[model samples]
Target: MFQRSISYTALLVGLFDASAAVADLTADRVWAQTIDMIEEAGGSITALATRDGDNLNISNVRFTFDIPDTDETVIVSMDGWSLLEKGGKVHVEQPDYQEIVVKVAGQDDVTARLGYSVRGDMGVYSEVEDTLIQTWDIARAEVKLIELIAPDYDPAEATVEFVLSMNDAISNMMYMGNGHQQSVQSLGEMAFDMTIVTPAEDIDLSASARMRGLMNEGFQTVNFKGTPDEILAELTAGGGLRANSALDGMEFKMEGNVEGEVFNVSFAADKASSNVNIDNGNASVSADINDIAFNAFVPAEIPLPLSGGIEKIAYDIDIPLAAAPEVQQVHIGMEYLGLGISDTIWAMFDPTGQLDRAPIDLIVDLSAGVRLDRDLIDPNIEELMEQDPTQFGSIESLGLNELLVSALGAVAIGSGDFTFDMNDLQTFDGIPRPEGEASIVVSGLNSVFDQLIEAGLLQPDQLMPIRMGLGMGFVATGEDELTSEVEVRSNGGVYVNGQRMR
Candidate 1:
């Protein structure tokens, strides 16, 4: 973000010159032309707003492409009545699928406000057409910069580019038979680096997304290093069975021997429909996060001759993540059909490499069924069904809310074998998410407790709430030596307790 004040006060000295009439501008023409200009400059725009006097007021302008693209455009808010250049300030109306206003502080020094929206398709499509036709949208979303950085001496001009590091929270739904299918097998995030053009620009910027229909998971290559024991201890810490859930919105910060290279986010979708690979020095990790679909029928409202309102729905995603180190292949799969949707995902890496910046070499060999929200394209689908389930009498309604509750209920424990290619692992925080594949042997109910103790993450006396809250308990008599083995490999050597686990 470039922060400063531009006092067009000197316009009278020159700018306000012979061009007395700055191309008679209107909001519409200004918007259209803004797109033209940004595209001309290798960028695109998303929202538009105006800084009234000393304040910035945004409009209700939300735009998305037919399919996702590297949309980099600038937003110019021309008065509906005049072309008077509006003060520059960027605001985000939707960051985390939720509604919140992003405040932009700009004085007379600002030129034009810019906005960006990026989306790209990278699914395991049978053909290019399949991937192209798919449609995806964000439901509930949120994001925060929390912190940022600027170059030295405060440059002359700067523009910070913020990208929504892809699949941070994407849940996909696939078409199966007459109904839709859904899945939970997921992927990770990649942060983007912000570009600074000058010192006269504002430094505040934002990015966010909310995936509602599918599990946005793909493979990628990454390079990173961290203390072995510290990481392993954190890994086996007491976050409990719902580690993913607990780490849900947490982002990692890593320091490396490398410079700005780890700062930019690069997410690969199909990458030509191939597999992903990453090699680490001591522990590099490389694997493919394929979308596997489970077969199921999603509820859909059959439009009637004189029907009105929305429909009701319920679905599921069953996945088995397993693999071997030598091959380091993560076999992720699901069964989905017909109503299968056309979807998308986009990524923009961060300027500072403190966050996600892993090289991606993903393969879209995944075959899974997605359970879609009938309301995606049609809004009335859910309304009609909820107002009156009878409207869906002819449609197969599997009492949705019940199904999920029961399915979630059936999971006695969130225990699973976790494998990380020591070679590919970039960093180790409290611990790493259970990745790769291994035979999971759930024994002592002490999993949540033992994990924390083994990795020396938490004390048994610490709030066990994180564990018991998830409806889990120790299956062992006491904290006896619990054992589980993980067979994995990586270009970089593996580390456990700061020691090698392979």
Candidate 2:
């Protein structure tokens, strides 16, 4: 179902991309440009256009597209939409309701119908030289699942329903020459709800999500003259795409019943933001969310409800998309700060409260240098890899700038740098040989293990091997503290505390 939803979304985006080719404010020009754009995108439109003075009434509006890389086709049809030339602007009048159908050609032959609706005006278009500007102030916009049919599922016995809505939305879009486009949009609230039922299995599932104060902005350029794959190649090569978005708060909840058992889950976050940039055949993305809380209840499993919270959750990554002669730099960082579980949950295993209840935190920062023999974003990458699997890419160097894990009255921190001999793949089980050293420090390890044993979470028999391993590899630095210096030689030998391990 989620995959179907994504396909539907792609179809909608394709529709918007098809409509971004407005060159003049006249209704006839707008109509002609829309048809041309649709055809250029490998799509077809069926509509009767009638000019009543300056207003163009389009009826029986239907659009069909064979989605690339899939055996599915999408059809969107509406009855009473028009483009009116008012003064120097073109007003877009969309019908209050429309239906979209998706047909999948396969063994099952699935079909899905989606209903879309708008409460207010869709937008207004005005051309400034070669650029077309569209502004919209809409009261509400919504999409809902109308029907779904699939093999082996009886509609009378099983049913699914879904609805997505946005309210108090405003947007501005600019379509410039040379296939450049920019857009900014804001919404007061957005929400989605889905429910599924199957009587045969006695199953019922319902999920809902909501977001408030959402804002998004994006810019992209495309080569429309090329095929879909070619266009994607051009964009990833250099044309580039960028986007940013933020939300004040968001929440999700789910409840389900399976064979008389019931379960509930929910999570919420206070604020979140994300951004992405793709240029020069390289891409970077970063996202963060703060003040997160989660809760779950399952009577058939745990008798008590479990709850947890996190102060912040974030990650950042950058990577090269195209081949480069010189090695390109890559980075990845992640953080989960101030995470805590309810005492009720902890007490289940640690009835004596011997373990520390302090919040757990984890942090990791890594960077690498990679050389790519072929473009990672190439459409034929998979085929190329199949022909010569080892010619794809190689990691030449890696740096672990920071690593931290703190929980259960224990902490471990480490950092390392390594250079890899990509040409040698037999030394480390078909992996590149590495040469570097990493230093790690662990504190309160014995205390934490003892507490775990007391809580019966760790058996005494399990401690012997762990202790033996630590004795062989780690050195005692202080009371309840252990340190290790791990090194990998160019000869593929590994050593810990000057003791050869491999």
Candidate 3:
């Protein structure tokens, strides 16, 4: 639903790109250019246009278009619009209320009404040489679902509502003749609420989300000469997109009833940010969230509510897009720091408090060299995979740059590097044979196990085999520290601490 809303918003805002490479700006010129742009993008617009001095008044405006790559059609209608030209600048006016209807083939149709108010300038357009720029400021904007028509569902039997509101938003958009477009936007606060009630079945659902201080910047190149499908194909073939966004804080809450069972869930984050770059058959993405908390309650499943939190969480990845005979570098990393559960929940498992209730931390960083035989975003990838499952790619090498896991008075750290023999798949049971060595150091394992035994969480007999295996595989490095080096040879031999195990 959020994605659909964004698409609708984009289409509506994109129509405001009216400035052309003309020396003098006029209301008629802007209107003509807007119509041309819409037609070029495979859309149609109808309106009653009238000129009143230097102002152009348009009424009964309706725009219709088919969404790319989907079986959905969107119709946007507004009661009135006005454009005024003064001092080489065109001022674009917005309607107080607009209606948007989405018709999905073979599915229910949804209708939404948007209401907005602008404080200063709604939108101002100006052109310099072959470039056009638009600036806008909005005081408040809102969207509410007005109607939904389904063939199988009776609207009278159920009640549904969806509303999204934004406050204090500003945006700037620039279009260059070289088919490049860039936009930057900042919002003070945004909130969404949705609810559904079915009286016949006695079901109720509600969800709400909010975000504050959000800023986003995006850059993409357009192919004015190509059709929508052609442009999409070009994007699939590596027409790049670069975008980044950050938010000061975000939170969400949901409550629903399923099969007579009630559930409640809530999540919040103090800060979050993300970045993405896709160019030249390569892409990289990274995201970070700080001070996050989540809680969930299911009365029938678990009597006690479950709750957890993390001081910080991060993830990053980089990969290739196109096929290549030579190996390409790929990377993936993730981290969770200061993760802890609620005391009430933790006490359920460790009621005696024999184990330390320290927060857990985990970190993993990995890199690999892979050779791709097919494009990662190939349209027919599923069909091709059915013919040859291994045709997509093969991993040549993998390196674990860093690994750390710490929890409950115990810590483990390890690092490893391995190369794969793509031709040999029998030694590892239909898997590429791996040859490498890994070293792991663990501390406080015995102490933790002793505490667990005393806490009645584990039995001596249940852990005796594990202790014996550790004794044979690990060497004591410190008072309670153990270190082990495990290696796999090319000839299917396994060694522990330089001693052959298999």
Candidate 1 local accuracy as lDDT? 0.28
lDDT of 3 at 448: 95
Model 2 residue pairs with clashes: none
lDDT (CA) per prediction: 0.28, 0.85, 0.83
Clashing pairs in 3: none
Clashes of each: 115, 0, 0
- Between candidates 1 and 3, which one is better according to TM-score? 3
Tens digits of per-residue lDDT, candidate 3, 174-290, equal 776677777878888899999999978888999999999898888886454666556556665668778999989999999999669899999999978999998877889999999
Q: Which ten residues in a row have the lowest lDDT in candidate 3?
A: 1-10
182-299 in candidate 2: lDDT tens per residue?
7877788899999999989999999999999887888887655667577667766678889999889999999999999999999999989999998888899999999999999998
Tens-place lDDT per residue, model 1, 1-502, is 0111111122123323453432322334334544554555554445546655432343554432221342332233321211233332111122222222232223322222223333332211111111111122222222323222332433234434443444423333222221112222333443443333333433332332322222223221211122443333332332111111111222222211122222211111211111222222112122222232221111122111111111111122322111112222223322111112111111112122222122112111222222222212123557776786443222111111110111100112122233332233354542332243322223333544554354455667674675555333222222432223333343333442233553
Give the residue spans of candidate 1 off by over 4 A: 1-195, 200-379, 393-441, 444-451, 454-456, 460-502
- Candidate 2 segments whose C-alpha is farther than 4 A from its true place: 1-24, 33-44, 65-74, 95-117, 142-163, 193-207, 222-238, 256-262, 422-432, 490-493
